[model samples]
Target: MTLLALKNISLRFGGPPLLDGVNFAIERGERVCLLGRNGEGKSTLMRIVTGQQQADDGDVMRSQGLRIAEMPQDVPKGLSGTVREVIASGGGKVGAALAEYHHLLHENPDDLDRLGSLQQILDTQNGWALDARIDALVAKLDLPADTDFNALSGGLKRRALLGRALALEPELLLLDEPTNHLDLDSIAWIENFLADWDGALLFITHDRSFLRRLATRIAELDRGQLTSWPGDYDNYLRRREERLHAEAQEVALFDKKLAQEEAWIRKGIEARRTRDMGRVKRLYEMREQYAQRRNLQGTAQFTVQDAERSGKLVAEAKNLSYAAGGKTIARNFSTTVLRGDKIGIIGPNGVGKTTLLRLLLGQLHADSGEVRTGSNLEIAWFDQLRSTLDERKTVWENIAGGKEYVELGGARKHVMSYLQEFLFTPDRARSPTHVLSGGERSRLLLAQLFSQPANLLVLDEPTNDLDVETLDLLEELIVDFAGTVLVVSHDRAFLNNVVMRTLAFEGDGRIGEYIGGYDDWLRQRPVATARPAAGTKPKPAAVPVVATAPASKSPLDSKQKRELAELPGKIEKLEAEQEALGLKLATLYASDPGKAVETQKALSAIEQTLATAYARWESLESLRDA
Candidate 1:
C-alpha cells in the first residue's frame, strides 16, 4: 500500500527553489534513506509529509487515517516529567491518564483512593492494555522509567525520543540523523530494531554502516531535485555515478550543437537575407534553457598542513592507571604508539575514551604508573564539542585568527581563498559561527584543525555531524597523513577504513590492544555472554594482541616516478588553457554571443582533464611518500 506520495512539490524561500517540482512516494514496509548535504531542506520535506508545513505548489497524497511520527534532528524542548510520562505523551489523552496513574502509584503507594480514581479512568478508557505495553516498551528499551527525561545523556535522550515516536504506533516513521550522537552499540541495536520494523520508514543519516544495514532504497535530494534509486546504498552509488556521467555527456553535446547554431545566427546579414526566423527563435529558447540550468555544488577540497616529523616514538604508556568519579577508566593499561601509526579507540559513550586520550597525552595525571611523551610532538586535537570554535566570531575570523593570510603547507594563502577550499562562500564565511548548521560547524572545525601544522592528531568523535563526502575526504586525508594519529570515534566504517590498530575499552578498566579496526577487534576480542540492551551497562572483557610495526616504504618504479615528475607541469598547462577559454567565453558573451558556447565547451573539457591529472598526481604522490 502507498502510505504517502508527493507530486510537483515546489518550495522556495529566496533565490532558487529548494524542492523544485519534486515527486516522491513511500509504500508499506519500505525503509528509505534520504541522502543530501546539509541545508538541503530535507526536514522541510518531512514537515510537508506530516502536514506540519505546506509546499508552495504541490499535492501531498496520503492514505486516509495515516499516522505519521517524526524523531526530529534535535530534541524538542519544554519536555518535563519521568521517561514514562514523556513516552506516554505519544498516546494522547489515554497516555496522559496512564502517566498520571503510574506517577501516583509510584509516588504515593499508600494513597489508595487517588490511585483507585486513576485506575478507574484507565479501565474506563480501555488503557490497561496500553499501560502494559508502555511498561514492556520501557523494559525493552532498558530505560529507567522513574528518571527525569531531562537528566538523560544525549544518546539516552535520543533513545527515549525514539521510544516516544514508537509509542504513537505510526504507520510511517521519520527519523532525521537518528545516529547523530549515538555510540556504536546503540547504533547497532537501533539498526537491528529497524530491520525488523513493520511499518514504512524514512530517515536521514550520515552513517554509511547504518544506511547499508537498514535502507532498502535510497532517495537523494540534489540540486533542487529528488531522485529515488531502487536498491541499496552501494547500488545507488554506482548508478548515480553513471547517471551523472551520462548527464554530463548529454549536456556537452547539447552545448556543442547550441554553439554551432549560435555561430550560424551570428552572421546577422546572411541569416536576415535567408529569412530563417525559426532558427533565431530556436536560439532564444536554447538561451533560456542554458540560463536556467543549475550547476552542481562544488566539492570541498582539503589539504592538511603538516608539521615537521616527530620522534620515531610518539607516546608510550606503561602500567597506566586512571580513575574519575570512582570509576576506573584505565587500570594498568599500557600501549606504545610509533610514527605513522593510526590508532582507533572504541568503547561505549561515557566510558572514558576521552579520558584515556588525555592520559596518553599527559594532559591528565595517572593514579599510578606513568606516560612518557615523545620529543617535539606538535599535536592537533579535533574536539567533539566544537569548543575550539568561538560562537560569537565569524567563520573566517575563527579560521584566520584575525590574520588576512593563513600559512598552508608553509605557503601564505589568502584567508578567504582558503575558506573557499572548504566550501564556505564569502557570505557564509562572514556569518557568525553560531548560525552554522551541524554539518557546517563540523566543516569549520575541520578547517580550523587543518589550518595549523601537526605531526600528531588526536580526534574525538570527529565524524559526528559530517556528511559522507566530507567524511570520505577526511578519511583520505588521514590515511595520507604522514604522521601518528590517535582518534576516538564510534563511526564503524571510519575506523575500519582509517585505523591500522584498535584499542578496545572493556569492563573493569581493561583496555585491549588489537590489530585493524572495529570489526577486527570484534573478531579477536573475547566473546561476551550477550550484547547489552539499550540503556544497560556493558561488561566487555579485554583481549590483547601485540601490534606489529608498519613496514618500510618501497621506492617508486621508474615509470611511476616519471609520471609523478611530469604531472605538475601538465596540470599547470591545463589550468592555463582552462583560464584562457573562460576569458574567451566571457569576451564572446559580451562582444559576440554566438561564439560563447563553443568557448564554454572547450573550458569544460579543460576542467575535466585538469581534474583527472590532479587526481593522478595525488595518487602517485601518496605512493612516492609511502
Candidate 2:
C-alpha cells in the first residue's frame, strides 16, 4: 500500500528551485535510503511529508489517518525529564497519564491517594499497554529510564529520542544521520534492531555499511531533482554511472545541433526569408531548453601538502601507562610506529582512543614509561571537537588569514578560487563559521589542514559529518599520502580501506595490537567470558578438573599440516632479514644517513611479520598434540 506521495512538488528558497516538479511515493514495507550532498533540500522534503512545511506548488497525498514520526538530526532543545517520561510523551493524552503515574509510583510511593487517582485514569484509558511497551523499549535500548534525559551523553540522548519516535507507533519513520556519534557496538545493535523493524523507513545517512545492510532501494536528490533506483547501493552505483554516461551523450548531440542552427541563423539576409522563420523559432526554443538544464555538481578535489621527510622512527612507546580521573586509560601499553605506517584507533565512547593518540604525540604526560618521537616530525592535527575553528570568524578569514592568496602545489592561488575547489561559493565563504552545516565545517577544516605542509597527520573522528563522496576521496588521499597517519574513526569501511593495522582497546586499560582492520581483529581475538559489572565481587576461582580426550578427535587437515610445516622456514627468513636490516641501519646512520629511514622501516616490518609467524607456529604445535 502506498502510504504517501508527492506530486508535482516545487519548492524554492530565494535562488533556484530546490525541488522542481518532484514526484515520489513510499510503500508499506519499503526501506528507502536518501543520498544527497550537503545543503540539499532533503530535510525540507521530510518536513513537507510531516506537514510541518508547505510546498510553494503541488500536492502531497497521504493515506487516511497515516502516522509519521521523525527522529530529527539535532536533538530537541527543550526536552526535560526522565527517559521514561520523555518516551511516554509520544503517546499523547494517555501517555501523559502513564508518565504521571510512573512519577508518582517511583518518587512519591508513600502518596497513595495521588497514585490511586492516576491508576484509575490509566485503567479507564487503556494506558497500561502503552506503559508496558515503554518498559520493553527502555530495556531494549539499554537506556537509564529513571535518569535525567539532560544528563546523558550525545549518543545516549539520540537513543532516547529514537525511543520516543518508536513509541509513536507510526506507519512511516524518518531518521536523519542515525549513526552520527554512536560507537561500533551501539551501531551494530541499532542495525540489528531496525532490520527487524516492520514499519516503512526513510533515513538519510553517510554510513555505507549501514546503508548496504538496510537499504532495499536507493533514492538520490541531485540539483533540484529526485531519482529512485530499485536496488541496493552497489546496484545504484553501477546504473547511475550508465545513466550519466548516456545523459552526457544526449546533451552533446543537442548542443551540436544548436550550434549548427546558430551558424545558419547568423546568415542575415538569407535567414530573414519567410521560410527561415520556422527554423529561427526552433532555435529560440533550443536556447530556452539549454538555459533550463541543470548540471551535476563536481566532486571535491584536494591533496595534502608534503613536508620534508621525517626520521624512520616516527614514535615509540615503551611500558606506557596513563591514568586520568582515577580511571586507568592505558596500562603498560607499548607500540612502535615507523614512518609510512597508517594506524587506526577504535574503542567505545570515552575509552581513551584520543588519549592514546595524545600520549604518542607527546601532547600529554603519561603516568609512567615514556614516548620517543623522531626528528623533523611536523604534525597537522584534525580535532574532532572542531576547536580549531572560530565560530565568530568568516570561512574565508578562517582559512585565508587576511591574505588574498594561498600556496598550492608550489603555485599561488586566490583564496576564493581555493575555496571554490572545495565547493564553497563566494557567498558561503563570506558566511560565518557558526552558520555552516556540519559537512561544510568539515570541508573548511580540510581546506585549512591541507593548505599547510606536514609529515604526520593526526585525525580524530574526522569522518563524523562528511558526505560519502568526500569520505571516499579522503580515504584515497590518505592511502596515497607519503606521511604517516594515526586516525581515530568509528567508520569501519574507512578503517578497513585505509589503515595498515589497528589498535583496539580491550577492557581495563588493555590495548591489543592486531595486524589488520576491525574485521581482522574480530577473527584473531580470543573468545572470553564477560567481565563482572562495576562494584561486583569477583567470583572464586574454580577448581581444575581433568577430562580425557575424545577418541574420535580428527587429525590436522592437509592444508593445515602444510601451513604448519612452512611456518618455521618463513620465520627463519624474517629473522635473517631483521638482522641484516639492523646492521645496515647502523652503517647508514654513520655513513649515508639519508638512506637510514628506509632501512629502519624495513626492519620494523620484518619484526612484526616474524612475531605473527611465531604465534602461528605455537598454535599449530598445540593442535598437533591435541
Candidate 3:
C-alpha cells in the first residue's frame, strides 16, 4: 500500500525552488534511500515530508492512520529527561494521556464505565507494552540502561535518539544521515536492524555499504528533480555509469553531426557570396541550428595535475600517545610512512584517529614517543575543521592567497580555474567562503591543497562533505598522487578505493597495521568465534580423519551413508513450510493493503527459518555415504 505520496511538490526558499514539481510515492515496507549532492535540498525534502516544512505548491497525501517518525541530523534541545524516560516517551501524547487517564481511573473507580472505556482504549493501543518495546530498542541501539541522556556523549545521544525513533514504531520512518556519527559496529547494527524492520524507511546517507545492504530502491534528488532506480546503491551506480556513458556518446554524435552541418553551411556561404542573399540566409539559419545543437552538450571539466615526488619517509610516528582530560586517547602507536604510501586511519568514535594525524603533523604533542619527518617533506594538511580558509574572504582570495603566480597554462588563470576543476563554476568561485555549502567548502579546500606542490598529505575526514562525483575525483587524484598520504576517514568506499594500507585504532588504545585495502583488513580481522588462521593449530573437530581398515568399505562410502539418510527429511520439512509462508505473504499482499506494512517482518522471520534449514540441509547433503 502507498504509505505516503507527494504530487507536484514545489518548495522555495525566497528564490528558486529547492524542489520543483517533484512527485514521489513511498509504499509500505519499502526501504528507499535518497541520494543527492550536499545542498541539493535532500534535507529540505525530508522536512517537507515530515510536515515540519510546507511546500509552496503541492499536495502531500498520507495514508489514513499512518504514523511518521523522523530522525533529523541535528538533535533538538529541550530534551532534559533521563535516557530511560526519553526512550519511554516515544508513545508521545498517547502515552501521556494514557498515564493521566490511568491515574484518574485508579483514584476514582466510582465512574466504572468511563474508566473501563479509557482502559480499553489504552489496552488497544498497546500502551502497557510500550516500556518493553522501548527497552528492546535501547538494547538494540547499544545504549546502556542506566545512562542519563543529558550526560551521554554526542554519539551516545544520537544513538539514544535513534532508539526513541525506533521505539515509536511508526508506519514510516524518515532518517537523515543516520550513519554519519556512528562507528562501524553501530553502523553494522543499524544495517541489520533496518534489514529486519517492518515499516517503510526513507533515509538520506552517504554510506555506500549501508545503502547497498539495506536499500531496496534508490531515489536520487538532482537539479530539483527526483528519479527512482530499481536497485541497491551499487546497482544504481552501475546503471548511472552506463547512463553517463550513453550521454557522452550522444553528445559526441551530436558534435560530429554539428561539425558536418557547419562545414556544409560554410561551403554554401563561400560559394554563394554576394551573388545570392537567399543562400546566405539559409547558411546562417543552418549555423544557428548547429549552435543550438552544440548547446545541448554540458560543459564541465575536471583535471588534476601530476604530483611532484619527494624523498622517502615523508613522516613517521614512533610510540605516539596523546592524553586529554587525564585519559590517554592513543597509546604506543607506531607507523612509518613511505614516499608513495596511501594510508587510511579508521576506528570508532573518540578513538583518537584524528589525534594520531595531529601528532604526525606536529600540531599536537605526544606524551611518549616522537615524530620524524623526511628531508624536504612539505605537508599539505586538510583538517576536518577547515579553519585555514577565512570565512569572510571570497573564494577567489581564499584560493589565490599569498601565492606569487596564480596563472596556470597562461589562460588568465586565477583561483577560478582551480575551483572549476573541483566543479565550482567561475561565478561560484567569486562567492564568499561563508556562503559556501559544506560540500563546496570541501572541494575548495581540495583545490587549494592541489594548487601547490606537496610531498606529504594529511587529510582528516576529507570525504566528510564531498559528493560522490567529487569523491571520485579525489580518489583518482589520490591514486595518481606521488606523495605520501595519511588519511583519516570513516568512508569505507573511499578508503577501499584510495588507500593501500590501513592503520586501525581500536578503542582500547591499541593500533593494528594491516596491509591491503579495507576489505582485506576486514577479512583478516576476528569475527565472532572465527580468528585469522595465522600459525594456529587446527581444532580436533576441524581436522581430517583417515581410516586404516577401509579396504572393503571405503571411508567416503561410510560418510555418504549418513548424509543420504538425513537429506530427504530436512529438505521435505523446510520446503513445505517455505512454500506455505510464501503463499501466505502473497495472499496478504493481494488481500489487505495494510498487511504490506508487516510484510518485511514476516519475510525476515521466514528468511531466518529458511536459512537455518538450508544450512542444515547443505551440511547433511555434503556428507559421503556407504
Candidate 4:
C-alpha cells in the first residue's frame, strides 16, 4: 500500500522551477535513498512531501495516521533545555498523549474522559519508556544527557538531534545527511540500526556504503526531475547509464524524422509557392520536443586541475603531543609522510583526527615535538568548517580575490575560465558564496585548491557535501596524484578507494597505524560488544566458533592430485588478472569512459572462469575419495 504519494509536484523561487511536475510514491516497508548533488532541490522536495512546505503546484497525499520523524542536515536552532528532556519529548504517540493529558488537566482541574483516553494511548505506546530510550540513545551516541542542547558543539548538537529522531520511533523516518557528523563507530551503529528499521525510510546521504547497505531502491532528484531505479547504488549506476543511452536513441530517432519533415517542407513544397502550414507547424513542435530532453542536464560537472609535484618526504612528526583545555588530543603520536602517500585519518568524534591534521600543517602547536617538512611542500587545505569562504563575496570574487585573473599550473588564466572549470556559468559565477549549495561550495573549494601549485593536500571531511560522482573523481585524483595527501573522512568506500594506509585514533589520545584503508582498519581492530537496550539487539560475538573440519578426504589419486595442484595455480592467475582489471577500470574511467565498460565485462568473465575452476577442482577431489 502507498504510504505517501506526490503527484505533479512543481515548485519555483524567482528562477527556473526547482521541481517540475515531479511524481513518485513510497510504499510501506520501502527503503528509498534520495540522491542529488548539493542544492539540487532535494531538501525542497523533502519538505513538500513531509508537509513542512507547500509546493507551488502539486498534490501530496499521506496515508491516514501516518507519522514521520525527520533529522535535518543542520540541527535546529533555539533548542534549549537538557538533552534528555528535549529528546524524550519529540511528541511521538506516547509523548504526545502524555503531554496532552497534562495539558487538559492544567486547563480544567478535572477532565476524566479525555484523561482516560490519553492515558490509554500513553500506556499502549509505552510512553513511560521514553526516558529509558532517550538515555540509551544518549549513552550510545556518547552525548551527555544533563547538558543544555545549546551548550554542545555543532557536531554534538547534530548527534543529539539524531538520537531524538531515533527515539521517536515513528512509522516513517526522513533523514537529511544523517551521517554527516558521525564518527566511524556511530556511522556503523546507525547503519545497523537502519538495516533493521521496519518502516518506510527515505533518507538523503552521500555515504556510498550506507546507501548500498540500506537502500532497496535509489532515486535521483536531478534538475527539476525525479527518476528512480529499482535496486541498490551499484545497480542504480548501471541502470542510469542504460536509461540515458535509451533516451539518446530516442532523441536520435526524433532527429531523423525531423530532418525528413523539414526537408519536405523546405524544398519539396512547390518551390515554396504555397507553404504547407500544418507541416511547418509540425516541424516546429518536433524541434521543441527534441530540445526538451536535450535541455535536461545533470547537476554540474567536476574537474580537478592537476597539481605540481612535491619532494620525496612531504612531512614528518616525532613524538607529537597536543592538548587543549585540559583534554589531550594526540599523545606521543608520530608518523612520516612520503610523496604520493594518500593516507586516511579516521577516529571517533572529538578524538583528534582534525587536530592531528592541523598539527602536521603547523596550524597547531604540538608541545615538545619536532616536525620535518619537505622543501618543496606546498599545502592545499579543504576545511570542513569552510572558514576560508567569504559569504559576502560572489563566487568569482572568492576565487579571483581582488584580481582579474588567477594562476593555475603556473599559467595566468582568466578568472572566468578557472570558475568555468568547476561548472560555474557566468550567471552562477556572480552569485554570492552564501547562495551556493554545499556541494557547489565544495566544488568551488576544489577549484581554488587545484589552481594553486600545491604538493601536499590536507582535506578535513572533504566528502561531507559532495555527490557520489564527484567523490569518485576525487578518489581517482587522490590515488593518481603526485603529492602527499592526508584526508580525514568517515566515508569508508572513499577511504578504501583513495588511501593505501590509515592513521587511526584509537581513543584515549592514542593513534594506531593500519596497513590499509578503512575496511582494513576495521578488520584489524577488536570488535566492541555494544551494550544492548530497549529495541536494540545484542551484536553477535566477534569470532564465531566453527565445528571441526569434515572427516579428512581419502588420499587423492596421482592424476586427481596433480589437477588439484594445478587448480590452485590457475585460480591464482585468474584472481591476479581480476585485481589488475580493477585498477585498470579506475584509470579507464578517468581517461576513456568507453573502455571502462569493456574492462568491467572482462573482470566479470575472469570471475566466472575462476568459479568454474574452483568447482571442478573440488569435485575432482571428492570423486577421487569415492
Per-prediction backbone clash count: 0, 0, 8, 0
Model 2: residues >4 Å from true position, as ranges? 104-117, 268-275, 529-626
My TM-score estimates for the predictions, one after another, are 0.82, 0.82, 0.72, 0.80
lDDT of 4: 0.78
Instruction: Please provide, for model 4 over 457-479, each residue's C-alpha lDDT reduced to its tens digit, 9 standing for 90 to 100.
Output: 89999998888777877887788
lDDT of 1 by residue, 157-218 (tens): 88888888888788999999998878877887788788888999999998999999998668
Q: Regarding lDDT, does 2 or 4 come out ahead?
A: 2
Worst 10 residues of 1 by lDDT: 585-594
lDDT of 4 at 304: 42
Please identify model 3 stretches exceeding 4 Å from their true place.
Answer: 12-18, 77-91, 94-128, 144-154, 246-308, 319-322, 402-412, 526-626
Mind giving the per-residue lDDT tens digits that candidate 3 earns over 1-626?
Answer: 78888888998775446788887878877998998877779988998898899998989989998889877776788875567666665678655545445446556768778777767876787876875676677666767755568888767777887877876789999988887666666776677778877999999887777778889768888767776665457657876677668967987886687676556555655564644566557657756766544222122244333345666767788888778877677788888888889999887777777777777767787889998867776778887778888999888788788453365433445556566666776778778899987777877887777666677888888876566666776788789877788888777888899999998865567778888777877876554423323222445565666867655433445665576576677667766764565445433432443563465456556567767867765654544332
Cα deviation of 360 in candidate 2 (Å)?
A: 1.2
CA lDDT scores, all candidates in order: 0.85, 0.86, 0.72, 0.78
Error of 3 at 474 (Å): 1.3
Candidate 1's C-alpha runs over 4 A off are 106-120, 267-275, 529-626
lDDT (10s digit) by residue, model 2, range 1-626: 67888888999998889998877777776788989988788888889888999999999999999989888988888998899999998777888888988888878899999888889988988789888889988987888999999999877888888889888788999998888887777777778888888998999998898899999767788888887765568867887898899999999999999999888877777545745677778999999999988878778898999999999999999999999998899999999999999999988777888899989988899989989989899898899888999999999999989799998778999999999988899999999999998899999999999998899999998887788889999999999999999998888888988999999888889998989887787677655623333223569988997887866646789998999999988998898887676556544532343365455557767778998899989988888888
Model 1 gets an lDDT of: 0.85
TM-score of candidate 1 versus the correct structure, residues matched by position: 0.82
Instruction: Itemize residue pairs with steric clashes in candidate 2.
Output: none
